[model samples]
Target: MSVEVRAVPGESLSFPGRITRVAPPRTHWAPVYRRRVVVADVVAVVGSTLFAYALRFGNAHAHPVQALLLLGLVPVAWLAALFVFRAYERRFMGLGNEEYDRVLQASVFTLALVGTTSWAFQLEIARGYVIIALPLGMFTILLLRYAMRKWLHGQRDRGLHMQSLLVVGHRQGVLAMVRQISRASYHGMRVVGVCLPPAADGRLGVEERALAALGVPVLGGLDEAADVSVSAGVDAVAVLPTPEVDGAFLRRLGWALEETHADLFVAPAVTEVVGPRVAIRPVCGLPLLHLERPELTGFRRLVKGTFDRVASGVGVLVLAPVLVGIALAIKADSRGPVFFRQERVGLEGRTFGMLKFRSMVVDAEARLRDLAASSEGNAVLFKMKDDPRVTRVGRVLRRLSLDELPQLFNVLLGHMSLVGPRPPLAREVAVYGDDARRKLLVKPGLTGLWQINGRSDLDWDESVRLDLRYVENWSFGFDFMILWKTLGAVVRSRGAY
Candidate 1:
């Protein structure tokens, strides 16, 4: 078979198309992850149900002993229901929102089953016990999942529980996938090697140099992907589109990968499209990707605005003492007003005054020109991890994000939401392209995907991409997820600077 392809550039390889073949190390961590989730669910389900049963009927002297015996079996049935939902399956655990969704589904199914049996049998004991236990069990299980996910994420950050990935594709496709996957470590797929498309041209050296920059080893051409994965002990092979790999080729490649015990995946060229907006449908025996138009105007916008105002109003009141203390600290530590105000580009490209507790000296702005050459920020924003202009108290304030507290008032005033795109400066807005201006569809936020993902540390493109994604895929549930994630992001102070 004749194959005309271009090598996807990643990392330089000392042994291109070669990997040491030995008995593969049993390094898979799926068992540990699976076991932990199952144990946590069991504890949550059993403890909540038992506690609910005791609370409801423990003091009732007329309660039959048989009722208690049957009540003890609920946890067993609930555990079985979770397995029935495949909630603890290694494939579904620690990836995306599926785990949590499955947990909720399992709990609901178990409750429904219990209720149905009770009603069908006409049992008198089916009253308040299940009602109390159902909600309690669900809440407890959700909490446990959250805690376990947090712990699992920490492990993944330290290079644990990762799937060894081999990418095969064209130069640009592979590079894009590498960057996207590299930024999202929580996805748990680590790029171990890459297989570029075969090319008989002199540009192979150039391709090698570009792929080498990504720091993953270059492993031969896509034609040898199965052999390469087997030799490298790869857990997954991500097949990206190249001129040579078509539907027929991919079908055979999937079958080939199974011989090496490697899971197969395909990465589409699409980027940052998420939520219900994107779907896959089969028509005429071909899969078609569908993208829905983003909706900006609706009752949801009103609800979001109202949530921002009410939450921020309560926040400002509750944080009054802390705000006042910060004000005093700013006065004592530097020569400036307690609050800093700047004109930021807001919804629909409107300009509004954004407020923050001052975390820099009064001359911070004047010194910007002198420090211009030393800036650590990207094209659209100015940032410095250890700028000399910061006051002593400013350092602590910034690290803990206390300096952002004054933005609550901005939220209360409707100039910003509690979660949306970053509030851009006038200069930043001046440089925005037509497409980037989509970020102005919603109000700027005190915290958003930008804040929770990697505030100042993210590269310019990633930051812009995340904000635009938020704008295009804005939903009430997404906002809630961001708000929930914001607490952990702040506590960890990750990429805050």
Candidate 2:
């Protein structure tokens, strides 16, 4: 058996006559991470329960024996419940909603079990103690998990604890997949090398040369990918969409991967569509991927609309003082009205007056024609970094996103949503293709994917892509996530003009 040196992105390694197997280094990190999470969970559970007990009983001895026993049993049962629910699974340790969802399910299960047992046995259990302890414990656990996740992501960003992937596909597909994976390194997969489909001239293609330029080595042609994967000791093999890699080829690759510890992943043709909208069902013994249409109407939409109105109404009421202060400031700083209402296309191409605190001069619109030549925005939207039309207070309001606070009223009036596509100007919508027009299916948002993502820094295609992605995969949970992230974006003030 011949030993092989470790693989690098730009440099090719030789395996000689045969390759000696070595354990994947990245796999070891997962178990270490899971152990830390387990310890953190244990500490959170015990501390929260003890704190709850102390708070509820106040060192008094009403039923000390039962309370002590209950305290001891709860932590053990909680850990058991988490394990039973597979909350400690490696796949969910570092990212995604599955880990948090599992922990929540386990906590709920533990609470129910405790309540049922106490009732069945006629055991004396304090309602206050149970209520405080369960929720406190769950919240503490989630907090610790979130901290650990951030640390893990930081480590991965620095090129640690990441799975090395050997991507096999057409050059274009491979490049697209690699770029996406690289951009989201928190997902913990790094494309170290690629195996492109063989060219007709048996020479490197332009895309292959581009990959090499980016320090991603081209291992071999498609037929040699399995052998190369094993020789390269890759943690996973990602096969992108390509006609050359058929079902039979995938089966053979899967079998080949079994010899080593590598996992095989096949990318579907539909990349933009994700989450619950796409499902795989077995039909006639073959897996068929079913794509569902976007749900713009029905009970879910009603719930979404209801949530928007309630949330925006509450927000407006709570921020009334701040809103008044902003209005006063805008009035003092500008010669125009306190609020700026611009006509923007909303749901189904309907026009509505979107509100914002006036952040520009009274004749800002009249001056737009002169600045068109120096516009720094995308093809559709006209934006200038240092436009002479902006007022002194406008910069601060725009940076902190205070100018758009008045849009909450639009949300309450059913003209906008708390989270959806950005409101487009009539001119912007005029150039829309069929795909881009899908953004009109839902109401415009006060802040959405485009805002949290680069905001004004994004080009036309990317902004439209993010909006389309949001439209394709809209849900209450998704909206909540975008709203949560929007707070951070506002604080950071990145890409704000």
Candidate 3:
């Protein structure tokens, strides 16, 4: 492939093609490498299934014929579901938690299919075998994928197996494209240079300076893009849109790249639409992108809510003894009720009394006025890293997060969630600006971004940012991730007390 190199005013030799290269600071790899990683995942799933069977059912007592049949059936069913689900598509293979999610989904679907088929045919499949194999196999496959991802990240960190890209677009588009590619280095792309299309003004925009800060070279204006690509040795050219460029210019740019043997990528202006939600249609030489919203209502919400309640209820039951111990400790250390109830905003701006084990003295609120002047809390809230109101046992409760256990009841009562934005106090909610009010759009959580991030350490702005991001990106999978991280955060207790 061709690439172009150009020297900017103060930057070193700019190989715009080097943006696509796997070296030094850039960690993104070629698209082909990502495809191979998916293939590796398929192999891992098969291998993990076999290993799970061998581990669960020892070779001594295992029925060889039954085992062999199951081994063949498992991989075939998994591969079928994965293919039907389009789980191995290149766009989703490299980054995000979606890859792991698909693997789990495919496994669950395969097991359900197997169960239904066994019952329909009256095949007398051993219940114990099915039970042991499904979960064990699923766990093994997920662990394997996690291990593979870690290795891939390590490779990216070492700057191997990356693609060199040439960004061709208006100044703003080029700057945005470069910034995105740079932030996602694990995707394996390096932008070596940019070719800004010709403008009526003949002067590049301030975004060009932004790109220069990223160290990407600016090849001459758009007309010289193909020549620059050839000299710079870039593998791909990413075409970013500008108001100045119409369909005819884009067509010509495509033809130029084709003659140079460089792969062409067109970035659409659409945002917030994920891969699964988008479909492309080509009609009359025009490419139309069809965006479909994921179904998040009716039965889906019911299922999610039911799962949350059932899971949280079981958790409360399992931790009952620990809860009792914490309550007793709080009582012994201070003269107050076991639980503290405060009015906090819930989903859709509804107010509810959030419950937590009292982690401070009985007169904590009465003393708030005295401590306000010396508060270490964020701008919109009052806090103290070393508040005098906190009891001896309260510190321990805060550190291990045992203080929030009583909120499990709130979750069961449908007033809170096992995961969501932290419930805001009445005063905090009252002062929330228009943008910050978005956090009230979802059900408040016992432990959320604010909880796992820093409980009380995050500034008001950072806390609000995390809350809004959680709302905008809410998904069942995301909730599970936050729950998992909450466990780690609780153990570490960083910035908790």
Best by TM-score: 1
* Worst-scoring 10-residue span by lDDT in model 2: 14-23
lDDT of each: 0.80, 0.86, 0.74
TM-score between candidate 1 and the true structure? 0.90
Better of 1 and 2 by lDDT: 2
Higher-TM-score candidate of 1 and 3: 1
Ranking by lDDT: 2, 1, 3
lDDT of 2 by residue, 1-497 (tens): 23223333454433222344322554689889999999999999999989988888896864666776568888899999999999999877888788999999999999999899899988888888889999999999999999999899999989889998989998888886776687678899988777776677655567766776666766677888888888778899999888888889999999988988888888888777888999999999999999999888999999999999999999999999999999888888868799899999999999999999999998999989989999898888888888888899999998899999999999999999999999999988898999999999998899999998878887798799899999999988888889888998999897788
Candidate 2 residue 60 C-alpha distance from true site, Å:
3.5
| Cα-based TM-score, every candidate | 0.90, 0.88, 0.63
**TM-score of predicted model 3?**
0.63
Cα lDDT tens digits for candidate 1, 1-497: 22223334652244344446422354567787678778888788878777777787677642464365346667888888889998888777776678888888988998888778767876556467778887888888888888777787788888777778888988767877887788788788788778786556535665466656766666767777766667777778898867788888787877777777678988666566777998999879988998888878888789889988999999989999999988998898777688889899999988998998888888889999998888788876778888998889988988899999999998988999999999998898888888788899899999899899888888788788889989989988888889988998889898876
State residue 468's C-alpha deviation in candidate 2, in Å.
2.0
Which of the numbered candidates is closest to the native, going by highest lDDT? 2
